[model samples]
Target: MRDLEGRYVNCCSLRYGLSFFIHFCNIAIAAQRVCLSLTMVVMVNTTYSHELHNSSTNELLTNVKNPVYDWSPETQGLILSSIFYGAAIIQLPSGYLSGIYSIKKIVGCGLFLSSLCSLLIPLAAAFGKTSVIVCRVVQGIAQGMASTGQHEIWTKWAPPRERGRLTSICLSGFLLGSFIVLLVTGFICESLGWPIVFYIFSAYGGVLCLLWFVLVYDDPKDHPCISISEKQYITSSLVQQFSSSQQSLPIKSMLKSLPIWAISFATFGYFWSNTILFLYIPMYINSILHVNIKENGLLSALPFLFAWICGILSGQMADFFSSRSILSTTNIRKLFTTLGLLLPVLFSMCLLYLSSSYFSTVIFLILASATGAFSLPGMMINALDIAPRYYGFLKGVTILVGMIGGLISSTLTGIIINQDPESPWFEVFFLMTAVCLACLIFYLIFGEGEIQEWAKERKHTRL
Candidate 1:
């Protein structure tokens, strides 16, 4: 079939198929991680804690079917942040391994391990808080490897021209996961009990893991089912950017690069803001806004649904600009990254002032999330832009920085919320906004879109 652009299309193209499969993999990765965000609401008994002051939100304590623990705010913070700690430990190593080994195997194994961890969370919870924390940490490590492997997969499977769209499609799965979990988990907790939510998602993940092992290949050339035309298109587009010859890593060069630092800091900013929304928004809505469990799930989910849409559209727009030469790669990256970071801050500030109005608060949140997704097509994939050869390793470094920031942000948020209890949201929002702005400025000043000399393949000279 010919598409509207007059290009021949293969409905069964393995490259596109791979993008979608990874998309589902990402969905599983996110669901496993964020299940705690909503479930924790029901899992913890706020009334049981002496540290907690009386609040109207304590009304939720009357109706929970599942057993609730007397977890202090600090303890809750540790549970939420433990995943990031495990993820950070694996990020660099996983990135390096993904680049050297089979992306298919690395990603598959990671997802399978993560799925296994997810399955054990309910069992862990029965043992004690410590067991659950340990389970989450292991899940985080596995998901980190899977996330890093995705960047490596694109290095081998994605055409240079199609990179933005393909990567965005895969990354959008993160938002999709958030949307589903936020929409469904609370209702499941209320109706069937909290453990069922974990059981259902983990079971789905296990099935997808089996499919991943059967269908995915490390590269376009390796897939037996990929069409010849599609294989040639992908391989030819990537040939100049990749090399089979192994060389020692240019660690020193990367350490000194301004662009690398820029990506790392920008990632930190993104993760800080993201951690607040993904992990804490449910708490904010329930505790502060007094939204019920079902309504809270639905409202929190709305922003992510819009964000997923915006992510996909921005990816398409980015590739269009690149293919048509309407803008330089640097400009495209800057423009989208700016939109992704700046407008969210503006919208979030608006959310604070308009918090008294429930409708306006939700609208602003939706706008913030929708606009923030532009970053997916922006700095999120800039490593691929400047260094396809080292994209996997570079992504790992940036993500490690991001995970550390997320870990700190989650812990700090819990500490801050615990200290004030009555009016902590404003202070938390302000700190998050300030950190995001500082990092965005660093990226705008130093980020680059051109490939570095150190990233290019070098010819070996025989002595």
Candidate 2:
């Protein structure tokens, strides 16, 4: 009887194992089937009528289709600076719109339109001066669309706890784009012409836009593709999570805040000082320091790369202090902001005074780059901290002001450099330092955020 019972038990256990295996196989097959079907659907949807990708580096560089094109230095400066102008100026309105509508929709539309503008740059260059200017203006507006929409996404997607890393990642795109461009553009430029750079950017814009429509869902709760684990993670982290109860924030009240002005001023200083690097750094190096073209481009890239790295590092620092619970959020923000702003201002001044040799100029830029890290945790992080709800709008507000500053800085620097290149660089450097210092002191006292006070404040514009 015992032997018979043992045999029966073993048989039952074996049957149970076989059934479980079958069930597991069925689940695995179902999951694969679901994945396949979803992928097919997404792929089809991704083929939007407005898909923007076209052209290549070699094609753009070598294409002389624009026989009317003139590649003068001034024209180049206008082309580049106009993009910043448009990006900064358009940010406010675009961001406000993003807050009112779906950020995903705003970003997707902006990127698609911007990619189209990018493709037409060569066409503009081919037409005449007027066409190039028009294309550049369009490009800048497109950037405003891209930047502001990104801020909207950041506010919604990034939780307070993880905002630091997310901000770093997003902001790093500016430099990462530059770094990738630098590494890749050299080969492209060597093989083709400068036109290829814009072509490459256009391609990037298209791919990113397509991905946005496919993977990105506007509201966290409304997302179809998100798994349960991801849904839990996002909702748990947001301090002011988006909901049906909340409506769009008031634009007028936000614009009137002293903190906004302070942030704007600091951003202005950043753009003002940095534009020199973008516009005339190579010329300065070649004229003042006598560096070769190959060396200058690499050296020029260093500051931006360092600034990007510092942003990542500073973010980690903020998170570290936050976890300890020793420092108030205000203090952590203030500390990093002050450091980011102050160091750049101070180092910028050093350029004015220091003329030891060619090496000294490079050293100044490297130090300034290191200091540029300060902006990351301060303005970039603090903007999100103050109003994670209205990040797109605020980013647009401050960025627009900064672009105005850039116009002033670049214009003045250009005029001064033409007359007396050496002394003017120094003078501008010191002036920027003073301006930065002024912004810093102001922020120390007036620029801060308190959540209790958040609802009490309203922006000036109701609409």
Any idea what lDDT model 1 has?
0.83
lDDT of 1 by residue, 229-339 (tens): 777777777788888777778989999999999988988988888777666777777876797767877878888899899889998999888877788888888888888
* Per-residue C-alpha lDDT of model 2 across residues 1-463, encoded as one tens digit per residue: 1132121122133222322322222222122111211112111222233322464664443344212233455655555556666666677689788777877677677777777776776566657767766776776676567666666765555555445545664565565445444445555544555455556666766776676677666666677755555456556666444433455576676666777777777778777766665556666667767777678767766776676678767776775566556676777777887887677667666766774766787888777756666566676556776666666677777877777877888888878888985567677677777776777787777667454245333436766
C-alpha positional error of residue 212 in candidate 2 after TM-score superposition, expressed in Å: 1.6
Worst 10 residues of 1 by lDDT: 55-64
TM-score of candidate 2 on Cα atoms, chains taken together: 0.78
**C-alpha lDDT values of all predictions:** 0.83, 0.61
What are the runs in model 2 whose C-alpha is more than 4 Å off? 1-68, 71-76, 225-227, 239-243, 246-252, 352-360, 452-463
Candidate 2 residue-wise lDDT at 459: 39
List residue ranges in candidate 1 displaced over 4 A. 1-12, 46-72, 286-288, 354-356, 419-426
lDDT of 2 at 394: 75
